[model samples]
Target: MSAALKIEEEREWKQEQKQERISPVTFTTDRTSSGATVYNVNRDYITHINVNLSPGCASPEAMDQMFKHIHATYSTPSLSVTRLPRTCEPPSDQITTTYLAVDPLYNSAILSIAEVRAMIGILQIMMVNPMLCSSQYLPETLADLKRTMTLMELAIRAYRHTDLVHSLSRAISIGVEQCRGLLEELTLNLASYRHSLASGALNLTRKYVWARAGQGSTMDALDYKLRKSHSSFAACLLALGYAAWPELKRGQLGKDTLDELAKFYVELEQESTSLRHIKVDTVIVQDHLGRDLPVPMIFCTSSQDFHVVIAGFCSGLAGDVLIQRGNYRILNAGDQVIDPKDFGTLFEPGMAVTMSILFYEKVEERQGIEGYSCPRCQHVNSRCTGWVTCAKCNGSFKISPEESIVSPETEQHADTDFIPNERSLFRKISISKYAPTSRRAAAAAASPAIANMAPSEPLKTENALSDGGVGDVALDVDDIELDEANMVEMNANTADVGFGEETYGMPFYIREKGTTNYLTSNGCRRAEGTQIIVHPRKNDFEKSAQVFYIDSYGALYHAASGLAVDIVDDVPCLRQLRPVSGRPNPWSHPLPEFSFINSQIRVKFLSDPAFPSCTDDLYPNGSWATKTFLLASNNEKDFHVHPISDFSRWIPTSDMEDSLSYDPKKRSEKTLRVLVERRTKDVGGARTSWEIVPK
Candidate 1:
């Protein structure tokens, strides 16, 4: 090669190196011969540097050191760096700078990279020193911390836009490390008051008796401080996420570090912010998909009243349905104290129920925003001016209430118990039969005269016993003695006087004097002359039992019939009273209204020769839908009545299987096959015993 050619190549290489040394901060994309994009550096133009530092951090010594470092790093004549003095006096005490052209949309706030680094450095100095982290310095420190984070976010955002995030890598790394340090310091601070930060009753105790006069106020202050600290800590974490985006994006942060940050974010969102609330431990609730929810209910107990905060089917965080049902109580564990009225009677020791304090996210009205947020559906209505109906849920709400987004009553009734059939309270049963005919019949079958008093079906015989002569069956003399307590008082002398107010007693099964039978309402048929019958007593006979209330004449009136029980032709029947005046005076003296009184034919049931009879034929043989049980008598009569064991009396079989197994899902599926056996003597059980063995 010629010496002249070698010299030309060498000069070109030297010129390229000199150009790279004083490269422009900004660059333009150019296409190379190979068709690959290349960023060209224009070194002829000098890049100006602006350094804006906080007033408290920018001492003369600090400025000189910073200047020396900048001058040493960028020694090329093409670079011009300047440090603005505090005397320049920006608009406010707040230190700000603007980065131009990096973000074509808007100039980045905290203009220079130098200002961001300075703010981060100041935060680090204050964080490291224990004395500087005192209570008096917290507020100022938090404000600065948030401000620095915002500036960092803007810088990172600008760099990202210009595809120059790598240029701020070092700054990003330092800022993240400082964030972690601040988080650690804040965590320790919160830990110092962990007990107070936890949710519970903040009552004055003997330990704080010395400061009793100021205890309430002290507790209030502490609560506020703790909440504020938490808020600041959360804000710091949020800022860290923004500042550490470059590292997070490139996977520079370790899995553990990333996981820790993610966990913190999740906890921040899940943690309840309410002052005093208890978490439900065992949720007997299941969602629509049949998943168990740990904290399915939110209840608030104020004064003596308790109501649900959130319940029923709701949209979950991920859009899956969260179906919660039933009432829940917070069970106080160990030394914990909960108000008796709010919870209930003291839960027995080792009661599987457990509880923890809960917090709630209080819904507040949004301000300075162009939308009205629905408290119910959380749908935003940006176009609404005053009262508006939510497009999503069709729920109506005022633009914003005079005081709150939701009224107190509206909140309480938002998600309550599901009422079946009843649509509007104003609609009466007589006018509309919205309830299904099957439900009415099922309900009537479950509890005879309680719902739908006017029976739609005829009386059916319960047992295949003869309606023969009562004289055929022998009666025991001792058992024939009637208890005076069971008899209703009938004072003919005071019949004219009124019993100021009506009185009713607990519903009872009226057992006849000589038989193991009760006075049963044949059916809820409102025919005037239907005679009440005597049926063999079964377990839980409240469905067939009677409720008696005292009338104005002190006479016992059957609540279902609104008539007094009287002996008409030697039969117990509901009888309408004869009116006193010829015109049936409306208001001479207020009397009970008698709508109809037809002398309908009566029903009679004679004692069966076989005292206790079988009801096997009575079972709906073809209907598998109806729950069936067999209650066999020990005497071989083989009575197969529906067995509903009153767990209070039955004993477990010698095989040692638990007969008291309860499963909420399969409630109708019986685990025990009970046999009603009569014993002459107490061999190992009661005379009228139920031998219940696992089915």
Candidate 2:
């Protein structure tokens, strides 16, 4: 062979030897070394990262999802079989090559500090060029940013606790540098913009200003929002820096590096403190970025300890706003140390500042209740009574003829003995107390012999109540038996109170608070979608007007029908616990449970855990999405029961004529729908409250 040919062959041989040396390393956990459970690491962590999510997002679930994605993606092996030539045909139907196995137990972990850096990059992009994101996803992106900062502070704490401070100091320093760069870039950009306008390189037009007025606000407002966003971001970075102080000071670093870190943190503290004196345009920030995510939030951190307050608020304080130098506690707007329990319970997590603002600003009106005044002394009393003894004047007088101050409506129905608006709930009252006050009176009036009988005389009835109400005199409010064992023992399966029919569960009257009205089903109908309404108690006991019960899951179910109470189109209606099963759509199914809030005074529907797009864990509101809405109905279908997830089908089908109608007679009204108010009030008043009144 020629010298050139020989050289080419030698080069090819060397390339093959290099390929053999660089082949993938494989291992198995087997002690015998048979290699039956061999595994290979593909190093495809990037494929595990979700591209759809903004790189800055770092919630615990997001981190866990990233890990799961990596685990699932890495376990699948690629096919690289080499086919043999037909000429080598001793038994030639097959092809052969090397096969590598993947480990099913393999999982990957990511550095939390890397996630923090990604968050900084995204925030920089948002501050510099927010237009790159669509308008709808802006809120989600801001939420991601807030979550990222929270995780960063938590990771720093973990590093200090786990003795990883020395190893993580380099990454923490890099993150701090990135944050400093971001602050500098934001400051320079704003300065350059102002300088260009001052130098006459850029000019504002009247039309431009007017157009922006309709859009939101002026250019100055935009500048304010940008500045606020920058300050808040800086405050967060400063907090993280303080949290990682132990890690930062772990190694023997050069004087220049230490000085640089100290200078950056000091500058951040100044910016954060200076902006605190200025009134931040919180409304604009909320509108642009979203509430609790990136408003004028304050983060408290300490250097001596791993103390970091996530979204703690500070108002009207002097000096070093970012660092909690001494107290190491989160202060609320009231300048009081916040309780730890308030984090995810009272207000949303990382939303103490926003909630405080709304509580002080938006809640302006107070609910008033009118009280009865004494005719002689003019002393106001909470409840009306026939006699009143004034505490201030020490005078006594008769206020009304009826010794007990009952409403006129209640007096008219007194002979029927209806218990209206029994407010003290969650307590057991005996069956004798729950019995109609007029039942004994009516029985006495029916027979003169019974009226003439002595007070101690033992009267007889076949199916008397279980609470020893066999023969009892008319009961006064004070004479009623309370402090009983339980409602189930006192009233369950009893016949004396006139529950001849079987009840599904513990029967109770859902009465409007401070009123003589009760939540009644229209007529005694057994229809699936019977309209639930508030109406005056009737003399005759009807199953429709009598009973409602709460199930184990907090769903209020009408005893007459097995259906549960749910709000559809803002109207309370009866719906099946579960809609028709096996439906292709899950939203077409009604949510299984409803919940009570504020001591069972307020009721709100709960989302299904299995519902599509429903988050697995609770968010800041203690729920996925729950907000208050007015209770009103414009059309009959508004009261129609539908699936909880079927919110799209709740549009009213009423005509314009019906919607615009003002005449009460012309409107197709059967029963009055329950009016849900923002505040609760007393009974016998126009604005009444609700109570769980037992039968």
Candidate 3:
């Protein structure tokens, strides 16, 4: 936007203006009052992923544990790729022979780019998504993926959170995190190739070719560039490795053939850096002093209508950008215009935001398969959306993508990647940003104070019924079936038991969708140290939790604690309060007779419309604490407790479609989908939705 800026300097700004375009088609829909239309604000082109995670726990420590589990279980992270030689070439004649040993690497690097694209950008896509890491990775890539995933799974397994959704989410998240390295590594490879190839051109020109004032020198420079920058095996054979093309056209090879090859390589290099790669001075850091830090960084001149990002740098061009006022526009990264949801998807609601320019230099190498040739499929410049399925062995690969170019042992120099140990993860847990998106703050406006009790002398079973709650008797958990259509609902019958019955028996775990943790308990003890917690599934998690529901008033009696979670205040922990003959306790919303949500039950205690808001208070401390309800026993000594409330839910352990067992190794084609909502109202579109694959 600066008036005195060079046309190339202003190119990025102009390019962004061209990218802000209108779509081919538009549709209109009614807006909702519950919240904004967060689903499709990116318009028709962008995709949406919503996680309606709301945790249920009384203790701040317990809440913290659940949140920690959610992040630990499901999060994506950026990974650094293998480092390479930094001795890049400059445009000038100054050449450093000190890096001569790394010269052959220039040829290897160009081939490396092609191979990465063939693997990830091509063949790998034929595996599953062919775009993400998993069983789809080439054998070598698969080994790396397994290392990362095994660590993630081992981390979650060591904990006691038992929610089905969390387990699946954590598994998929690990794949996403590891897959990031693939694209990043590709970019780095291209950067190295660009630098070395340019350097090779400069070196070839200096050693050969005469410095004549006129004719041959210009042709020599062009010929040197083609033989180095974009040279393939075919090009080398055509020029016979000649640095000067004087042997080209008028000398020996036809002029049109040499001229055409020269023009092609130059155009390819220009198109490669079509997007500007700019680096800013250190003054503009991504910080909190005064700038919007959560959103994707944008670049533009103060006066330009468009925006751009520092994609990569060229020491040769001396920061020069390729610009022709491009013929068409782009949707930019993520294929969407700048919007608030991009940042909202990152941080918590109401977190302060500041907008400012970014200072770091952005760089990218050609990582995608759009322009690379596929080795197996013999496809030229494969344009598949991350795909190149094979004909014989399907998508199987016998070699690693890196090894295809040059095996690790064959390389002149190599850098090793850092591997993490499982034991170290237990001592220090680290979860990334994406994990929190599936969870929401469980704090309310006013939290009831739970009383802290001291450990009392152990009590006998006879005294357990002193609270006048229903006594818990042993029941067969296996009697429960994954199929809801054949099973009898609590309201199925009459005088003996069923729909109008006074009491109904059910055994299940209440899982928090956001944290993927379960409501756990160690039963109630008469001692002062008896309090419950709401957290994750661990090695010794209680599988049989028999809950007695008093149908008339919704009194949820915990079989383990022999006490009902009251909707009362002044209780420090979830179980501090006892049930009385007062207002109905927490309620349960039964799923309608819909075949889709067969055996699902939603239990919401906090934030229920029938109850007054007194769960959270802006305590003097900078933290917001809210009262939570769950079945737990006090243990200031690593005590585990079960979370109870309307927010908690229980479904069959089997796949949602009943097509496979919960622990089966194979996946079924049928989708195991579950519908969730903030309230148990009409079965319309809910704010949250989830899919479960028990395996």
Candidate 4:
């Protein structure tokens, strides 16, 4: 190196003080990235910064100065902390909720180089336009996410020696106060925002919740992704914060929190897989190829009232999916209480069966980003995982951050569970020849009902006993019970309401009461009057969805796959539903109560028309889609809080599970005054009544 060149380098590295004061403070919603809102910058015209930002010779001081100046400059928008309306009108006022992204592995707090780079990338995007934060919302949130990610990484790096780990554990405890505080703030902010906005006005809807009314744009999705990334980081911090070295050594965390973490991953994988199989690629996530990506799966929830189970799916973050137990809440900042009363938690993430929360990268989809084999290396990843081997070294590599992009087939999802398919609502059923065949089905199937519904071919008999998946049996149509009381002719009064089970991926048959015929899958294809008859076949490409999971929160999820049972409206028909991974947590509602009904308990849908049994009477939305184990409710109110509400019930309809095989002959100490909802031949709507039942 020559002396002149050395001097030039030294001069380049010299940090210079500011030459002049930067512009005064202003605000702007328009940001350079066009993803999120920026704060205190001149939106009227572009502002240029003159500084070299290359490494070593790069001037960070100059960069900082430019950033400071940008912060100083401002363009005003209507941002006020006070007088934000709590109540809203229709459409705009349609109750909505905001959810956090899913992080099953809880890797946000870990200090891996790859994760750090990803965290930095996310922060850079947020800080890029620092003048557009939602006044108090995004600003504090971005700061917290950025700070915790960096500090944890630094803390771990400082503890390279095993002995050093002990010395530094206490230091982490002291420094993490800010991270903990910020996490609390973010949680409360998210909960309150959802609760307020769901019942609040519509246009303001976008301000707090993303993907509202299905109008969520590209930017809204980006913002949603950013939050999920931050959440992983937060959960990581919360788990590690204040821990002693002993706590670290044991690898033990509070079971409750750990269970929640388990939930996060389980939910993620389930939702993603379900979406892909169903071909409802509505959720969007980052391509896992980049080292600078956060937990890529968004959070998905059960599509039922007061659903507590949260799940998501991902290809990155060391797993394909994650799940956790979560509920939303409304907490005021600085008030500092997390109890449900003070903060008002709502665990009901309304309608995971309706729409999806994961938004896809529209631009990348157009570029044909996925589906090619590595012909040179003979590698096929099914997804564009950015797998590459150096021609010379055979070393592995990731798609460079400079080229970081997204792949949608990881079930390219946007927002929500679609709506009430008549099958989903489980409406009136008649003979296939007698069923309605005239109407048009919706443009898309919300549930997997269309693709995975019963086979489109004519009803054939399938024997129940076979080694193959939903294997080889021919069902005898004569077996269908013909008792007049159970099989009344079609008429308004004593009307024959048929809600034949339309199990796609065919499930075990359990006959409905008074019907000799077993409840079975009826192929859905905008076709009506389909017979609920079984088809004989050994399962091949089809995945069997058996072993239904009914969680404590009254959510009925497919155990093998985390897909929730849901319905769609407009052109009512059956649709299998799943939430996309990596979107914010769905807004939640209060969890419902449970009761024991001779082992098998049932959940009810509390609505204007409550679910009543075979009383020779029925209504459209009443008992439709309410599964054998699950119930439906139109009442969006506090079904969880009020055990006395007539809209809710826990009946034991052949509910004999292993756990429910209690001492029914004896009245135990845990006896509960169960509020059962029932309708009769004389009643107008179902009413709630007390039934003494064992817990």
Candidate 5:
């Protein structure tokens, strides 16, 4: 081995040993844990010592004296370092390092206040710079950048507190302007797309709008290729931008803005990847950005513009002004308030302002009949006027003259015997008292004779004797006895009548002067021999009072109050009763059974014809007399025959008894009489004397 090579090896071996023995200590400057430098401490201590050590211990400022003592102690050397290594060499050039030390005594020695303050200032600046940039160092880089700007502002405020107010205001204004500029750019893009679509260029409009929204910068070659391979990549980017910045909402591309955008990706038919269809209508850009944006430009599509404007109106946005346009007069939802001049700009001539206009026009075309004419009187008029009188017939009508005016009176008279005289009859009976009494007595006296005659018997019997005759009259006592025996047998064979059963007999007759009258048990008066005068002023058959007749069987028959005779001078006749074995007697009419329940009178009548005949008599003219009677058993103390010429005045004998009982605890007779009278009056008839009789 050569000397040179050995020397080189030795040097290398020494270098290796040196590398292994290198010290591990390294020194670097940093902020003190208490955020103050040693120089600052020393300076404060020196100032304190100078003030207190100069004999001020007993002064009024004793605290200041104690502080001075502390200062003196800190100013003096507490410990000292004599020597330190000057320089160090790298053993193998593997890494570089530095070391430092200070003489403890000198470092602790008194420092000038100015030098201390200067060092403190450096430390403060260092501390604040890191805080100002802390936002940059946080986890989210973009957010941190924003925060860094805010922190820098705070730093400026803290450092120069008085000047910060005006500076911060200016910075904020600048930030707002920047945001506004960006928003304006977005609005322009939206408007451009809308204009293109309105110009009938759908394809170009979509390409330009989507490209501007999705690629903030034109796509790189690789990015374009990747987007083509997975078109969803571009859509996702566009959605992200729209979410982050509400301004991007204007660039959504499609003619049917909401529908087209929703189907944009789906219509592309790129099925090789997983991507959700984006619904533009449902997409909420403003919500993501936490700011409200102007109405989206995509809504300006010709069809969508009208809908959006109408909807705005319905939502109560400037509705009054928006609805004023003649074209958009029929206000609906989504309408926008634009000047009439601006409305022309929104739509071209020949295009309908709204579909609603057609509907309104159709409604305006229908016209209903406004006037009517009377059919009967030929009166032409407007308005129903509720009721009117015919000019020709003087008949009242409810129908409008234009539609149908009818004379109901003439029509009723044609169909029925409803004479005007009947109405007047009600008023005549209401005033007259004598008409009722004579009617009832005549009915009662004739009932017995009427019941004895057969219904088929001739109204008159013939007399064969001459006016002058001389003859030998012979009486056959056997014949008289046989006739009497036959009469007794007939009376014994007569059927007994019950409350709900019938008796039969022939009607009887009566003769007055040269005229004969036929009276039926059913209370019909038939004049056979002579005419009975019917007073023109008094004969109102319909309003004539009713009269009830009691037959031998004790059943009632009803008769009309007015006499049915044409001769007013003739006296009326009473009829005789005749018994029939099997047939029902008209005089034995059943009375209605009635009781008071819950303050209302409830009546039950026998519906079967096998029951006693009802006092319903029909005259030749078709007017009938009806008698309704209430028969009650509970209150009956005794039976009584009550003659009532007016059916309306007849009251139940039981109700009268209930009222007239002597017992105080029972119903009072006065109350009963009063109630009966009231009830009789309600029925509208005149009553005769009531005769108490044994049942």
Candidate 6:
């Protein structure tokens, strides 16, 4: 095996051992218990050189001698240092934590070209002391360092632009050559010293060579490694950043580099593949093609969420008949569309389920300056939105729209005609007929209830299994147990009460429990059936109205002013329920109003009361709940619930694999703690606890 492979294997073995030896630990709500401390880490000092030449110590005549010494000691194109009189103080808050050096002199010290470049990059963003940059008493040695820094900065900038790839590559080549030349010079000088020792001009040749050679060789090896790693990282960044450019196709990279990159790419692909399974809840459709038809398959992956669409046929027919039956050609990996029935036998019941939905793409034409054509869909438009609509089928949707995009709840009647009928194409199966009558029956059965619940919604809510509710066979006990801890926690004894006040503006209230009265934000009150304690700001009923108690399911139904009820349980309940007298209705029109339980909490829509309820009680069949919540929005399209699975896939940069794997013990000794505080309007008000912890 290659040396690289050997090193990697050994590293993996060490990591496994390390993981096995570590014990599991947890953090509680309390401020302090047991954990690594962040405060213990110490900052290193950064040295600043002040070149002051005095008449008695070093006169103007000694300038030439100083220059000779600097030239002989430091290997560089030039030698100079900026020197201005100023006290050296530590870095302050103006500096960003990202660029802060772990240690000023030792750990983060610049010993070679790679370190120099990295340090310059970091320092560029920092608020530097003006005295450090000024050349009031500039040393000659610092001038060369400045020159090198300037070149590196320019190279990095050029590398960022679209048209400077070739130039950047050439610059890197030159830098590598310069490094090689420096190493050769050091080697030659060492040989000369050895020759002097042989002539008895130098004493202790072995020790001298051992000391110098050891330091030089070690530094050289480190420099080389750093440069190589940086180069590889840069190349990857460039490739991924400009992947859409046609010029950067696979052929652009030279053979050896391409081979190395391909390996890296394959590794990334594997990682993404693993992540994809963890990130999505995909349904497996068996016999996707007709029994006699040969279906072409193309499997690809991306960093975003998307739906898969397949096309199949019920019977062999010509183009027009095929179109009428909603049977289209099957497009394969190579983009070739073939007859759906030509390659298969008659599709039997459960042969395959084919449907159409918008697939995800990487480019958006509508947003691009000069609309770029999508490589996935081959369509050109204004913005590169990274979504496409099937021109042939008229199915249009973004593959992965930004999280902020508003998706309003669809009116129940709006697309009734468009709903696909599975029974029309597949063998008619009675899901309800086969459903189990008891919990045990449900657990062991493989009936239609399982199929209905598996693809539509998640099987369990926060406390389904714990509550001993049985509905669909797809409902797993494990999933219910996993979600039980997250179930909503609310005060159960609170009775439904009315506070005749306008809900449009912020409402404040005080509820008396026992002898203590607790002042709380009316915003915290949700659910119709529960009576909430409200402390009115004013006693005038004409100005401030009493809040009313509505039914509860953790949703607050309030009759407020300026609010128009659009869809209440899929019905216009505005005309049905009017606000009680003494209640200042601030809603746009008199309508039944409801509040979201919490700003952070989202709930899923189960069914529309106006329509026949779906026979299957469980909607989804996963370990996590499938629920949707209405996000804050003025438009109907603003409310949509993302699947829990999709939400989990969005791991932030701070939670990347490396960051996640890094144990706190491995970090510097900085102990972090959580602090609890209580806030209230009065000095001796009822206490509500809040905790603060390190991010």
- RMSD to the true structure for each prediction, in A, is 37.8, 21.2, 34.4, 28.7, 50.8, 29.6
In the range 1-695, model 1's lDDT, one tens digit per residue, is: 69999999999778666654753343211122111111223433222334433223446577667656654544343445222222225434322222212221111222333444454455555446432233444545445455445445544453343223322322333334334444554554443443342244233322353244343344345435534533433333333332333233434444654554455434433432321232222233222222333321111211111112123222232111111222222333332334433231232222433321111112232545467655455578765444456676664444322221222443443344223221111111110002222222232343433233333333332221245422222222221111111111212212212222322222233333334544444443333334444455455544434544443222335656655543321223444432121111111111221110011011111111111133343323312111211111122232221121422232323211322331111111111111322212312222122211111
Q: Which stretches of candidate 3 lie over 4 Å from their true place?
A: 1-503, 512-516, 522-534, 539-541, 544-552, 568-695
Q: Which stretches of candidate 2 lie over 4 Å from their true place?
A: 1-144, 148-505, 511-518, 523-530, 535-546, 551-555, 568-570, 575-671, 680-695
Q: Estimate each model's TM-score.
A: 0.16, 0.28, 0.16, 0.20, 0.12, 0.19
- Ranking of all predicted structures according to lDDT, beginning with the best and ending with the worst: 2, 1, 6, 4, 5, 3
> Could you tell me the C-alpha RMSD of candidate 3 in Å?
34.4
Q: Residue 396 error for model 1, in Å?
A: 29
**Model 5 per-residue lDDT tens digits across residues 1-695:** 69999999999778656644644432211222211112222212211111212112245367546545444455443345211222353323222121111111111111211232233243334324221111222213222223223332322222121111222222222232232233334335334434445445555544576466552232232223322322222232222223222111334322343343334323323431323442222111121112232222122222223333334333322221222232232111232223332231243322222221100111111125354333334354455454444454443333311211112332232224223332221111000001122222233334444446555442222222345543333223332333344445544333122111232122211111122211111112321211111111123342132222333222233234221211100111221111111111222112222222111222222111111222322121211111222211122232122122221132233224322321111122321211111122212122211211111
Residue-level lDDT of model 2, residues 249-296, one tens digit each, is 634544544555556455445544543543422111111011332332
User: In terms of TM-score, which candidate is strongest?
Assistant: 2
lDDT of 5 at 624: 13
Model 3 earns a TM-score of 0.16
The lowest-lDDT stretch of 10 consecutive residues in candidate 2 is: 356-365
Please name the candidate that would achieve the greatest lDDT relative to the true structure.
2
User: Per-residue lDDT tens digits of candidate 4, residues 1-695?
Assistant: 69999998777545221211234343322223211122222223222222212122225476456545544543222354111122223323322221111121111223232343454455445445422223334545455456545545544432322222322332233223223433344344444544555443644566544445332343344455545555544443332231222223323444543444344334434433322322111112122111211211111111221111112221222212311122112112221212321111112212111111111222232235353322223243344433344343332322321211222222232212112221122111110111011100111111223234354322233333335444433222221211111222222221211111122222232222232222122331111111112122234212232223333223333333333332111111111221111111111111122222221223332111222332333334333222222221122222121111221243222222311322112111111112223322121222121111111
Which has the higher lDDT value, candidate number 4 or candidate number 6? Answer: 6
Distance from true location, Cα of 106 in model 4, Å: 11
RMSD of 5: 50.8
At residue 393, candidate 4 shows an lDDT of: 32
Model 4, global lDDT? 0.27
- The candidate, 5 or 6, that scores higher on lDDT is 6
